[model samples]
Target: MKPRLHSQLDVNGEAFAANREQLLAQLATVEAVGRHQQTSAETKREKYAQRGMLLPRERLSLLLDPGSPFVEIGALAGYKMYDDKDGSGAGGGCIAGIGFIEGVACMVRVDNYAIKGGTISPAGMEKALRLQTIALENKLPFVTLAQSGGANLLYANEIFAPGGRGFANQARMSAAGIPQITVVHGSATAGGAYQPALSDYVVLIKNQATMYLAGPPLLKAATGEIATDEALGGSDIHASAGTGDYVADDDAQGIAMARAIVSSLNWSSLLADIKQDIPAPSYSPEELVGVIPANTKTPFDAREVIARLVDKSEFLEFKAGFDNQTLCGHGQLYGEPVGIITNNGPITAQGANKAAQFIQLCEQSGTPLLFLHNTTGFMVGTHAEQSGIIKHGAKMIQAVANATVPKISIVMGGSYGAGNYAMCGRGFDPRFIFAWPNSRTAVMGGAQAGKVLRIVTEAKMGAASDAAMLEKLESDTAAFVDDASTALACTARLWDDGIIDPRHTRDLLGLLFHLCKHADKVTTRTNQFGVARL
Candidate 1:
């Protein structure tokens, strides 16, 4: 029989209150950055209204089924980078997420034309590539609300080469039978013209949408030819020439046409019916905000987290007597069976062996794996080395890497060194990875890294080592590592999917589990060549 975990937390204690307050502050910071992007886009609301066009978000709302959840991806991309002097250009000049359109879950990418004319920055390109990968892997239909100004000419040197990969991905997706539907709401000139052209279905807005390989000036410069945007590649021209499948009078109608196209594909028929009645965890998910201490150095039982996440607070622990530092168990999350792996301390040799065996068992059962990371790393020292920590750690990593089951990771606290890899971190290709506001990821803690560097430098300097120089070096290195390992910094570089609130963790996992389940059940028709507009 499975055992129900008992609560050991002191909800009314001072420590819990302190931790909750700190986490709330961190969440506020993340929300504030999101608001900056919204404000930046809203600054152009009047202009969009004057043109009789919906705002980027408005179009997204209309495109998605009413009241459906939208899980935004890469919200902090390009935060305070490139030409963005302030933090306003946070969303990488676009909004992309997974949402339901006509009851069919789809990967939706909408260019934030309100910000910088929806220019494609380097970060924006990376975000788009990541989105395409998710759609391809999950077998979700791709929907793009295209209106970008193409590559930002200022960074054309950096963008000109890699930009071609976007078009290639589009073609590959089409050939893989993943429907790519694009609604061109505005100008798509230069390289941007290929976005709609490569889609399996294209919707163009009448006077507002203009798609061409070159605008007037560029055409005149290259071939001494002058042509207006409408005359070159407008909706009327594209519809007549067979480039666009549908033409709408405005943005709203274009979105409606895209929805109709998605409905016509009948994508929802592929989703397996989920009829199980899921019971909520006995403990409230809200308590998760206080489970991990604000000062990550403080230790808490990993079971506390699992109790609040799994159904009925029940877990069947694997090898409970063999190791205590590494916790491995089986539990049902949102009525879906999952193998839960978490850490209570640095991984010892015995813990690695236990986890490796547990992973294999889960694989044999075809259950999905969930990794909750919060470890310093594998144990190190003369004793650990003598005990074959290296060999055991490698075995654990090997199991994680070769496991064919769906893996999802949440960096709840510190994730350092080999521990990250063994726990299916981003590098291990967890189907979806997220971090909490207080989480930190790095090779090692800043202080530990600084001391290691100091020791190495002292040995290299021999007896002539300068103590003052070493102190400064250690301090600077520590500061840099700490800053770079922050959740904000890691997310800006697309390290994880996004930083999520602890309170919403269970719900997010539920959605991801559903998507992965659907992907495993659906089959697609493929061809050597993608559908082409001839």
Candidate 2:
């Protein structure tokens, strides 16, 4: 009796149409979830086999947006393992995809740790190369989270890994113009080391990561060199040897490092610049001296000096450890943002290179540039020569010259040598150059000048007592740079636009932008706006 009355709920047949559409969405969603779960489970098994490796797809889930859809390349790579009982691991050999880092489009490759100890398979190589090709074509940054078992030893008989290039393409992909980041969340030994070397940057974990062309066993067998794994390819080794650029503690840390790099590149600049306001200096230029110390030789932290002088102390520092002699960062004054570069203790070649990178960051970001001049000279020694000091120093000068932003030169301290040039001195094309009353412009500092003068004095007073001649030389060199002030150098030759107080830095910077000429970017990137972090 009850079943007869229901009539299959046909009373609202018309309503069923709208209900059908509503349920269709839910039904599709459910089906997708079901399929996704099933595929994910199969993927795990495919990646691991007997070893229980996690496929790139699963790793992407761990590394990228939750439940984000990814399109993979080289998903069907394989090797001799395909003929074995287990068959080749998933993605066949490669791990390539477009997914979301957070919610933005990001390219990623996750080494399948479950398969063959997550070694680079033939398919993996093809997938990586294919992904790199796609990234360059699409102008997207590539992030590779690599953790592999050296190489697929089982395929030694094969000419190449089943997927593609053995390991040579990693270097090729790196040079192809797209920013590639190699993140070592775990071991990346032997052939695996090549990827990070070719990348624009690399992020490595603490103890969990190792990246070396050869492990200790090979080194011991070939060269009788018994070395610890850490000594072979640790974070400190690469970063110090100039192989790795950045270091991280874990997967999260590696991801953060990648994010920070993305921020430093092209995206954050636009975000910061497009806004009408930038950090501005709150003080006057005349008050600059108060923020700085009077003694030239006394050691003081430039960071402290910067904090005391800028409108607001908030500034982003990049590679602070690498360049102790020079520093660059971002800060705001009067709500307007500006790029700041400062020199310290004795300018070394390393400092110069860091300075150049800083200058490029500023120029590329469209942020106004400011110079806090201080230098003895370019590091002139054997150490300087070996560190590619000349090249990096050139980069600094070139970066300044190439910059089109409003530049304000603040001679906060000494300006010596091409150090003056490096600091956006006369020729770097800063919109205008200024000097503090205390700034002493010279090619070399008084101490440095005294060394040269000592020889002259010694020669002149060849027969005289050494003490008397040395005293005169010291007196003369002491005031030489001091005499070379802004008025004497800048006003005398019209090299400088004006002089201002240390406090008035922000006002002058704002005014400089308000006055200087500007141009559209002249970078190699095409229409791509820039890559941003997740």
CA lDDT, every model vs. true structure: 0.90, 0.58
Q: Per-prediction count of colliding residue pairs?
A: 0, 39
The sequence of per-residue lDDT tens digits that candidate 1 reaches over residues 1-534 is 479999999999999999999999988999899988898788898988998888899999999998888889888888877887787777787999999988888999999988888897888888888899899989999999998888888888988888788889999999998999999999999788888999999999999999888888899999999899899988999999898999998899999999999999867642345436788898999999998898878999999999999889999999999989999999988878899999999999999999999999989999999999999999999999999999999999999999999999999999999999989988898888999999989999999989989999999999999999999999999999999898888888778989999999988888888788889887888998888987
Candidate 1: segments with Cα more than 4 A from true spot: 269-272
Q: Return the top candidate by lDDT.
A: 1
What is the lDDT, from 0 to 100, of the residue 355 in candidate 1? 94
Instruction: Give lDDT tens digits, candidate 2, residues 136-235.
Output: 5444567888887754676544425443352444444444445677777677776677666656677877766788877899899999989998888877
Error of 1 at 116 (Å): 1.7
Report the lDDT of model 2 for residue 238. Answer: 71
Estimate the lDDT of model 1. Answer: 0.90
Q: State in Å the error of residue 234, model 2.
A: 84
